[model samples]
Target: MKVVIYRVGQNQYATPVESIQSIERMLPIRPVPGAAAHVLGVANLRGSVIAVSDLRKVLNVEEQAFTPESRLLISNGNGYVVDEALDIADCADDAWEHVGEQKVWQRGDQLIVWEDLQA
Candidate 1:
């Protein structure tokens, strides 16, 4: 399957390319009251306002300040903040292994994790 891979610290994560509506640069976010701990708040993309979540928090990774490479993966009107947007790669179905609840791909010394942000 073709996937868009992104980083969250030293770790890499992937999601099906078709699953996300668009990949955008990090935008200014407005805080939302009574939102989930993982939710970063909301962002205005173009003219649409969407909720944004911290992928680092959701993936239980170390949180860091957004850098120039930080990105927003927009899916179904929701946005997920990631450390950086990596690349779009075609991964074979057999390359993926089910590791507990995560779909993981081991490429040499690096491991790529699959996340269903659309879910």
Candidate 2:
């Protein structure tokens, strides 16, 4: 199925484009107590409180300044946040080949796999 590809750390991940709500510019976040390090904070989206996380930090990626293109991809059902939502690409089922040696945590059908930049 065609999916939206995005970068986290040095890896690329694709999610079905239909699952994406909207990509919004980085909004001001209020700090939360006792939250994880990766959890940057929370922002009020419309009237709801949406928790924000630095996708780069969560994936142990190098930090960079938020550019005009920097966005927050709100996924339906999942409360997770994405760093910069990259372009949407077409990825068939056969295209998803397993890359050995690297371990990733999968939630439901979402395979959080790491892609080698060198390959």
Candidate 3:
């Protein structure tokens, strides 16, 4: 399967490219009171409003200050905040050798979460 690899601090995570609507630059986010810690806020993408979640917080990775270079990954009206957007690459057959029923995939030692973000 093809996926876009992104970094959360020093760790890496991958999500299917088909599941992503678009990758955008860091924009102003309106704080949502009473929202989850990982739920950063809402932003106007194109013309639609969407909630942005911090992948570092939700995925339990070390939190790093989001810089101007940070990217917003939107899927199903919801956005995921990631440190850096890496390349889109195809996974080799051997890479999926140990994956089970979990929505995540194991590529060597890295834990690749392959969720259908739209759902």
In order, the Cα lDDT scores of the candidates are 0.91, 0.64, 0.79
Provide TM-scores for the models. 0.94, 0.71, 0.81
The order by descending lDDT is 1, 3, 2
Question: Per-residue alpha-carbon lDDT of model 2 for 6-50, expressed as tens digits?
Answer: 766546566677777767777778889999987877888888888
Q: Which candidate, 1 or 2, would have the higher lDDT against the true structure?
A: 1
Q: Which model scores highest in lDDT?
A: 1
Which model is ahead, 1 or 3, in terms of lDDT? 1
Residues 70-107 of candidate 3: C-alpha lDDT, one tens digit per residue: 89988777999988987788986456533565455566
Q: Which candidate number has the best TM-score?
A: 1
Error of 2 at 83 (Å): 4.9
For candidate 3, the lDDT comes to 0.79
- The pairs that clash in candidate 2 are none
Model 2: weakest 10-residue lDDT segment is: 110-119
Q: Which stretches of candidate 1 lie over 4 Å from their true place?
A: none
